[model samples]
Target: MTILHVSAVKSWGGGENHIETLCYELKQSNPEIKNIVLCVENTLFHERLNETEIEFQTAPLAYNLDLRFSFKIIALCKNKKVDLIHIHDPSAIALTIIADKFASLPPFIFSKKTSFPIKNKKLTLYKYNYYKIKKYLCVSEETRRVTVESIKVKDKVITVYQGTSITNKSSETDFLLRKKFDIDESKKIVGLIGNHIRAKNLETFIETVNIIVNIKKRTDIIFVQIGSFTDRTEDLIAKVHELKLENFIHFIGYIPKASNFIPQFDALLMTSQSEGIPEVIFESFYHKKPVISTNVGGIPEILQDGINGLLTKKQDSAMLSEKIIHLFNNKELAEKFVTISYEKLITNFTASVMAQKTLKEYKNILNGN
Candidate 1:
């Protein structure tokens, strides 16, 4: 059976990365499973997909809600004899809702990656149709709950914690990656990996950096900001310059393969307004790295403060800074957190577990079970 994966944007950002990773793992599980990705035309992600063997298609419209693209999706689904359609975003889901009427209905799945406030009537209608649609594959428990409570979707939601394939020991010898970023050999490195956008709480993160620098007075302390931004890169750069955090912070624009460097960080950081369960958190823990994340989304489900990892209030720069500084000051506590996080990842977030659960749901949905 063919599976048609669709998204509104063509960028290989967080959501796109999740889709690619799932498709890769699904293909590995069943080599005969035909998989194809569909996105808007003329985007960088389309070019990036060319690097992989995964087949690709494009819609002739911007990511906006357009009825015309429904016909295009219908024709492609019919031509490919697609048995499953996994729409990755609300916009694409909106298009799919209309397309399903005109096209051969497939087992449609929607993965809600973001917790955006819905105001558009058309989108709300699509959200309401969750029961009528096929399974709702949520990336986090909180996401599934939100669909039930906020979006008013019924019991059709299924939680699939985001999975990462990286698993290896970090060589304490390879400290040169820190040196390359101008970080001191002796100082511990803390990292924040996500878009450099304002909504990601970059300003608060930078403020936290300033506090850490001031309290520690150790120039060896380095903070790494990985991933690129949209709509606010220039402003973020300007703010970094204004804050004069040049020596303390390193902003390495969107890393296509960030796992290669994730091992070097002593700890990982996340400060965002919203999220499903972030894939990076699982990856960091899988790599045996501790985290200092803001309390948001499904983070509470995964992180128990003073246990696995430290969690602070969202946008609270002082608490975030204090936790990082504490992790730096107390090596014993940091090591404990890292130890438990690793155990948790190994037990609950294995890629095989995620895949098997997903396949079971797919089969059940198909069998009308």
Candidate 2:
């Protein structure tokens, strides 16, 4: 079977990472399954794709909703005789919805990533495109629920949790990651990794950091945020400065290798107000580290309330701070949670499992099963 992917970005975001992991696993499972990624040119993720065995197709994607790209994409899909087309983002979905109508379109699959509420225009467009597609995929159950309501989709959306490729055991040397930042080795590092988008809820994470430091008076814990600076980062930086958290919190901008850096933290904290099965959840679990995340999206599906990790109410800094401190003080509990979380990742969320499920989905769609 041949699959062609239409992705709006070549940047190393959660969605791109998921796509790369999926392609890598699919290649490993079945060499005969031809898979290719089509993305806009000249981005770092696009260059990284060059290092992989999966094929690449670069085109000038105007705005994400660019219909002009349909001709180019349709030609590529036809030339490759792609049996399936998986649209990774709304922009690509718009293009596919257009291309399929006028061309010899393959069975199209759309990955529904957005779960947050939206305007009626966006909903209408999604509903229109969704009804025209052969299959729909959601990265999390929350995503499926929110998307169904927003788009009024009656179709059953498949939930495929984002999987990770990391399998290395946490080493004592992992602690040296803080030393690289010139941070004191004795200081505990609490961290979250993502781009500086407002939707990621960076402001709330900063608030949680302040609360944790103030309540514990523990100058020993440093809250570190590693990610690329987005448009909202300036405001976040201003907030940090105003809160006098310059010493307590550090922002390390955009590291290329996510796993190499994120696993170094004592705990991974996700303060996002929204997400669809974040890739970092799997990465942290694989590294045998506990996480404190907001109870949003499909996070609860992967992390049990008190078993695998801790969850805080969305935008609740006080609750988040308490959970972080709880994990820090109770090392044994943290370790147990990490161990269980790792087992969960191995048993349920892995590239191999995702690829197998995806292949089955493809067969089912083709057979109308």
- Alpha carbon lDDT at 197, candidate 2: 78
Query: Candidate 1: misplaced stretches above 4 Å?
Result: 66-69, 117-123, 127-132, 150-153, 166-176, 215-218
The lDDT of each candidate is: 0.76, 0.79
**Model 1, residue 240: displacement in angstroms?**
1.8
Q: List the residue pairs that clash in candidate 1.
A: none
Instruction: Point out the worst 10-residue segment of candidate 1 by lDDT.
Output: 166-175
Could you give candidate 2's per-residue lDDT for residues 1-369 as a string of tens digits?
Answer: 888888877467888877888888888778888888888777767877887777988877667656657876888887888888888877677777778777868777778765664446955556444655766678888887776665545565667766787533234343356666677878788879888876689989988988877666767888888788878888889988988889888887776665666567888999999888888888888877789999888989999878889998899999998888888888898888989998999899987887788878877877876
Give per-model TM-scores. Answer: 0.90, 0.92
Q: lDDT of candidate 2 vs native? A: 0.79
Model 2: residues with Cα > 4 Å off, grouped in runs = 126-131, 150-153, 166-176
Give the TM-score (vs. native) of candidate 1.
0.90
| Minimal lDDT window, size 10, model 2 | 166-175
